[model samples]
Target: MRFRDGQWLVAEGVRIEYAEEVYRITPTPSGKGISLLCPTRKVMSRGDTLNLGTLSIDIEAAFDGVISVETTHWQGAIRRGPDFDLFPAGRPDVDAKITKTEAGTTVSAGGLSATVSGKPHEFDVSFHPTAGGKPLTTLLNRSVGLAYTPAPSSPMQLADTRIFKHYLFTQTTLSVGESIHGLGERFGPFNKVGQKVDLWNSDGGTSSDQAYKNISFWMSSRGYGVFIDTPERVELEIGSERCCRVQTSVEGQRLRWYLIYGPTPRDVLRRYSVLTGAPGRVPSWSFGLWLSTSFTTSYDEETVNTFLSGMKARDIPVEVFHFDCFWLKAFQWCDFEFDKDMFPDPQGQITRLKADGVVKKVCVWTNPYLGQASPVFAEAAAKGYLLKRKNGDVFQWDLWQTGMGIVDFTNPAACAWFVSCLERLFDTGVDCIKTDFGERIPSEDVQWFDSSVDPKRMHNYYTFVYNKLVYETLQKRYGTDEAVLFARSATAGSQRFPLTWGGDCESTPEAMAESLRGGLSLGLSGFAFWSVDIGGFEGYPPPWIYKRWVAFGLLCSHSRLHGSNSYRVPWTVDDDDQSDEGCSATLRKWTHLKARLMPYLFSQAQACVGAGLPLSLRAMCIEFPDDPTAWSLDRQFMLGDSLLVAPVFEEDGTVQFYLPEGSWTNFFTHEVKNGPGWFTETHKFGTLPLYVRPNTLLVLGKEGEKRTVYDYASDVEVRSYYAREGASAILVDNQGNKLGKLEVKNGEVVGSEVLTGEFRITVVNA
Candidate 1:
């Protein structure tokens, strides 16, 4: 929402109200809290009766630590976005005082104060005078007040009649050097400084600027994060509408925002996650590779067995096998019944797979869509649990499937019905669900059973309900910390559902790199666990591409091999000629390596579960804020706080990476290098640059392992790299059930076995 036409004027028909001078200050009690009401006038009023004509703005604490500012005169309209109020919760250790000095009247909160001009009408807010002290990043002029108007009749047209009214807005006065980031799951660029972003979820691919998950929380280069806490649609003009200021406005009257004071970007996310919920810890097995029967790819018992047997023959240890949408009969998804054509005996097949040392966790794909052919469709339609059009008919579309009506998650009865259907699937030996196609919800002419929410707001939030239902159902069946979903779409607070993957990407090197960018961006936006399709999702990737992707995917928090038209099995892509080794060889090498690395990977995952941090960390997120070299690098990522993973994106095996201020050791080759600088190196196809920071202890699982949930403490090989004098490292089990502590003093490994397990320690120098 932009509102400016020029430097000094608001757009035509735009009403402006200014609170120039404070006429009167009175303290009043409302309910349980005390509020301060300050009436401001455009002109000075010497008499008390004249003050009655002025408008009053009420300020009070909404929560224990949050302050709410409301208008007394124009309080009819509902407020929307870009509202910042400074109110600290709990008991303040610092002082708060309103003092009138020669310069102005200042209100201070925790050593931070805003100076209101003493002059009659010239008022502005400024931060501390010194550079090293408290930083005040945002301020509102006297022109700030309640704004209300009609919504835009047209969405696509930029210049609608509503632009002149309250709907379309333009604002200016942004700082020149300010940079912006975090509009959840954005693919174009990691930094969103000058972008015109629309806060709407879509099924756009990695090449375009559009995003699957859109969040209105962004951290500026000036050291503050602005979180627009609204589920509705929000349009943001970040240093775009006006070159100097960030202008954001929504369609409603009530606007609530939080200006998170972060001296650094990491602090901002830490505080933000505290406000919203933090990501939960998923089970260790989820960290291993997951093989899926690609969408639209023909597969039966024979095809499934071949892929499994080929992986085993290649020594690629696969933990979970997912069956795509075709698992159910055509046109009857959510039927939760496996297609007899694919597998005549689903139970017998699952038992056989489990007997082969493969824990059979089948991924049955389902959406909110209920086709007319589905048995539950008529029941939901009759029970008023499906979304309906304005004409009082159930909203049906022929997009993915014929006559598919979306399940109305807003209704409690509808969620129960949906969960019941999934519960039945779980009972029939089905392990997990690929909760797909949540981004295509219709906003217009749609009515939810819960009429309290706006239709447009529910569009993005629909994924939350859809994933939550399936996740909760699984948790109830399997217990907490064991539930997972290979979800596609998401919004704020959706990280509670453990695992989400990059949706529908093409089979190209460019798409592969973009997919990594999307996952990194999503990880930065507060999602802890994420994965992308190994090879690709749309077409058959070449053997070289597939083999390279296998290494990358296996390293992810969750790994899956999926595709659209062609099979993703290693044998299908490997060349038949003698010049190249079989696809089975490529799969065996990476899969076996992933299995061996499970102890180290799962240990890092346990830390992610304990702390609300990402397993796959972006460079800046883990490195020092003062390190200038780390700010721009995006191609590589730190696997956790300890190790840095630089995947080879090009055909040639050359890789470039930077190590921040420490002696680092290569995890694969055991080569040590002194860092705090950049390094470029070449490698073979089997190995990439994976380095561990100095004074670090890594627990490597035994060679040729099978499962992620093993005795991590037993037979664990602890490799201690560049351990300085008096330095120590600790390794804990998956549930934090066992502790393995090793200490290094004077360049010697002083190992102490804290718990019962088989372990070995390797000490290396930089």
Candidate 2:
């Protein structure tokens, strides 16, 4: 997308038009706004028709705002993509008319205005009325905007282009100290200033740069977020383009983006979530540790029993037990029928687990792919519910399953067929579905039921339909606040589906950290709840890695122990008889701690569901923006607004963490630390640094309430930490439905509300 050769000149065959002066400015008929007409050339002849050509320039506004500029030529045809802005119109608060004087033209919004100097084909758009604390005006430079002629013989590409096809681009100037962040579920470095990113959703594993969820939005260190309002592909050349600018371009003629003006990154996300709906509240038990049968692992009734017995013997409370893909007979995934060969008595097995005080929630793996052996495949194919080739044959591929054809979710009948299958699983004891694999959709030579829509766009959009169908099915079968999907892929608005997991990561510490980065990025993108394989998803994690990941995973919105080619039983992976020290003891320690902390963790999850906030919060999102230390720290994350969790990423359990501008109390050790600085410490496998922020009331559930779905407010203990003068804290129930509010004045707990739980307050001296 970068077109400039250097600072002085444009590349060959490029045309540049500079707006030298504003010829005229007139108020619209509505009197709400005014448009500035700038002529590119300077000439003085009476009645001379001025056609100075099109202007190539950059345009931007404060975050949570929008800017519109038009560049049209007589020759090129205007191509448009899917129409957006279907919801509502934004209102402009500040306005000033553009006035053209002999010197220049000036138009204003807010207290800010720009003046174009009167010169022949040379003008600079500079901020005007440089008085007071007016909002900054963005200058459009040469490299920031451009218009391109399409190649003469390239075939027309639409929604289904695998990656980006042809694109017209513009690069925005980047400041030397500026950094980029937030592109949704990216596994790369949290800061994206120097990266080349493509806005396409893929099923690529967690080890690679490819992401299952790709968002065309990014907030800059300069305090603004730019979100391209397109479902189609967008290419972002972040600092990669001209070294000083972030360049972005789409394929079509029309380009529209919203500049979300947040004085802080958290405010930007809050505004963005308001535009796109915020995440709904999930159930409390969804926060507890979930144990799953790893994909392709040899597991049956006896194997499941052994793992459950071992976990209990070790006192590791498992809330949900998941059965992966093999629960169904091979090649008949969507049938929703349990494999009688493996579980001769399905009901008995479920009943046994339920009786064991374990909430049995089977993780049934499914995709849009319907194998030929599937019972509903014939029905779907007969009703034209399958994606078809150009020649009208059902599109079939042998990727995961033989002769697998994707269910055409666009068709109402197809969605019904898919839902019917899930309803049957719900009818069986299956409480949840691990809705996997919407990433490898075929975009080329495919025909959707909605023929007018492009397939490339459908690739990501496909997950929307896929997840919605499953989620809606569960909601219809169960009820509201009960439907959740372990969805693997998503696009814009896909946050409507409650829970999604970081897909298929390798069993390594690097993969574990990468998964956290992806989840953090995804959280910023609008997804509220996320999970990762506790021991990673691919190979067996070493004991140290497993125990560390267990602590990290249990703190996430959802936690599941899953893997491939190996069983995830702690004893199997970390056996004392082997050379390495077993993580079985470590797992036993943290798992019980997580279970004990369930009262606090579930409350945090409820808060996320209610406020559309992320359960695992990045330090920058919660800390003061002026604290430079918060921006660079990503290895550790705040569990909620109160608790800071620094996960041990290394073998020796060393963690370097920062406390932002406060007196913090360590949750495990009753020690207090005054901060606004960095601290490096080492600990045994038994514990890590889990700190509570000053002036906070954290609720702890009563003992023996092993399940997360208990009446949290009934027997909750409120632990008050470091309540500074004039500070207050509130303890919410498992639903984020407020339970009690507490305040501190003169270093004492005050403003206590009626409490139904066994609550206590601890005020630490600063």
Q: Which stretches of candidate 1 lie over 4 Å from their true place?
A: 5-74, 78-136, 140-178, 576-583, 725-728, 736-740, 745-751, 755-758
Alpha carbon lDDT at 627, candidate 2 = 72
Candidate 2 TM-score, true structure as reference? 0.87
lDDT of each: 0.67, 0.69
lDDT of 1 by residue, 540-646 (tens): 78876776777677777788888889888776786432233455665566666666676667767766654546787454543555665565667778777677887
What would the per-residue lDDT of candidate 2 be over residues 414-475, giving only the tens digit for each residue?
A: 78777777877776677878888888888899998877777777776777778878887877
TM-score of each: 0.87, 0.87
Q: For model 1, give the 10-residue run with minimal summed lDDT.
A: 80-89
Backbone clash tally (model 1): 22
lDDT of 1 at 105: 56
